[model samples]
Target: MNMLNVSSNAFMIAFFLYCGAFIVHAIAVMGRKFSNREPEAHVKKWGRFGLILTLIGLGSQLVYFFTRWAGSGHIPVSNMYEFMTFLSMMVIVAFAILYMIYKTSLLGLFALPITIILMAYAAVFPQEVQPLVPSLKSIWLNIHVTLAALGESFFAVGFAAGLMYLLRTVKFDSSAKVDKRQQKWLEFTLVVIIIVIGFIGTVFAFRASGYEAVFVQQQVTDVDTGGTNDSKIEKVIYHMPPLVAPHNSDTESYTSFLGMKEPLFEAPSWMNGVNAGRKLNTVLWSVISGLLLYGVLRLIIRKPLSRALSPYLADIDPDDLDEISYRAIAIGFPIFTLGALIFAMIWAEIAWGRFWGWDPKEVWALITWLYYSAYLHLRLSKGWQGRNSAWLAVLGFLIVMFTLVGVNLIIAGLHSYAGTE
Candidate 1:
């Protein structure tokens, strides 16, 4: 219990430190002209400060991880909370390594936000230290999951650099067809990121308010025991207000919100997973809150979000950002292959007596691997560079994210144990 408490405190310390690093990095990038200071000197001094803070934050997170491991009598990456937090830590590691190699403050500015958002997202899930399940009891769990996440973290850094490259180079004011199309897509990408932030903010807000809604979900299953049927009753709890009820569920206890005492509608029969309706409701809230946040920002800025932000990136070298992005992805590709594919197959064969299964998780992992493979080929062979390579890197990370998160949430398979409650 003492170790667990210490671990929790260390995690909080790390979170705050990372947030501080982000602000300092942003200052380093954006505050170059302030007080008529020499731009190069200003960036160098503040970028050093940001790097110090980031290193300290990484140290604190390591403390959190090892303490939790000691407290739990096993590695801490066995559950959603631990895995996501671990992923965020790995992202910091990847960012720190790249930042050191390139000495780029803009990389820190973009990458630290991703690390912070992932930490916040991880907090939205349950954080209790649960024992590893039978299948997850192998050493491969550590190798497969950790390496895969480390690889993905590099890919994440690549995404950040790629995005920075786009923001630095794209002609936001141009009305030409190519520039206009690029502007729209870039703004759309920024919107998706803001939506994720909104989702995290909404969850924490409702949680702090102590909101609750409960439902009794009744599911009927067909059995193969000489032609029989079974009815199962389960309770699904919603930490946020219920906007969509399960398909065949009845309200057990309800708290009215905004003059409403019932869900807006029941989920369709096709959405039959235990928490599918709740998941859908959460998605709806995320999109709503995200768009609302974007709208408010638009109103305040009086311009497209990307356009307003483009000037800050004007001094950055788009070519350097592109190079960093490509190098990071190149380094991560083989690590990802080893962890997500080779090690995974070894573990799966040992656990399930098969080397391959068309499970959703497995399929998505394969798809992600193939996509990145294509990306590398295109970059090396057809000489895809600048905007083209940047876009691919950005989109590749999205696919990696879906493989890690979305597949678990939306698809039921052998990896369902990895999903959130």
Candidate 2:
């Protein structure tokens, strides 16, 4: 078999192995409900099985990593699909090491599902390997992005712990007596969930329907020292249906969408680059599609996801969970700063002539960095202990995610390679 196919098979195997591990870990944590005295020895045996499967999954994915490098002649993290898979693999590896230190199956219970979710989310993107663009052909592509993704995987683990802490601690005053703070936190969490579900659902829908839209635009370049080319037609292909049609489609194949007016507001020149308003179109499509999906899911589920998970957590120690949540951010903060900010700056200076541009991606990276730094600072202080620190950790990851995923979808910039699938 060719390297790509072999790598694909390896990824699939790893997915199944991770799923098996998640199920076993979940059972080990909640099996006490099933038996009066679920033997600690039995749970430990099952945990070992889960750990073994996790290691096997890691090994299988390592094969994919090597074969993908051989196939692509570069690291697999040059695009969203590859970077996501690699990022999830890194999370699993980090969790493995942390598990060795903490020796807690509870961490696996919360974290393994994230790896599976990431793998699923990555599958929704364009998986085809392609030649790297001129901008992405630098060695920094591997070094900067590899470190950034690894660092964020730790943040992902922190998110798990943070979420666990909130679920264990946060409670509404009552149905009759609702504390606004608790209500707001719950609402914020649900909105984030909706966005994730919405994005994933829209991607799946487009892929299944084979829906494709093309954006035609004009291009200008300095030809013959001062001449420009406006005659060239740039065709931008989008698998998702357009919710907001672009006004610049010179081609007759243009299909107006959603009763949107002839011309919507235009993005800044830096946003869509040469493709005109395609980035704005994508952002609109994703937002509208996500809202619809979120509404439908809310109607069907009728409860926040945390409520469903709270029962299983009863046996898990709240203090331990809180500590893990704190420890995760504490561990992830320096690593993230080094990779996402420092290495990023060094690479940017090499590639783009400047170390900082306040590009959406760069700004968001800085925001993520500052937020986590504050999280660490507050954590070390006297007052912000359990709930506050957990909230900050969760919020920190949200910004990291926005830096990682949202900026790519909503804004265009030099740092798009890691995300612009």
lDDT of 2 by residue, 1-421 (tens): 3998999999999999999999998887778567566557667878888899999999999999999899878889888889889989989977887788888787888788789878878887778887887767788877778878877988889888878877776674455444456656756785666666667777787788776666676655556655655446677665655554444454335444456423455445444355446656655666776677767766786865556556777777788877877777777777777778888888888878888888888888888888877777777775688777777778877887778777765566776664365
Q: What is the lDDT of residue 246 in candidate 2?
A: 47
What range of 10 consecutive residues in model 2 has the weakest lDDT sum? 254-263
Q: Return the clash pairs for model 2, or none.
A: none
User: Model 2 misses residue 332 by how many Å?
Assistant: 1.8
Q: Per-residue lDDT for 25-90 in model 1, tens only?
A: 999998986738588999999999999999999999999999999999888887778888999999
Flag regions of model 1 displaced more than 4 Å.
Answer: 224-228
List the candidates' TM-scores in order: 0.97, 0.84
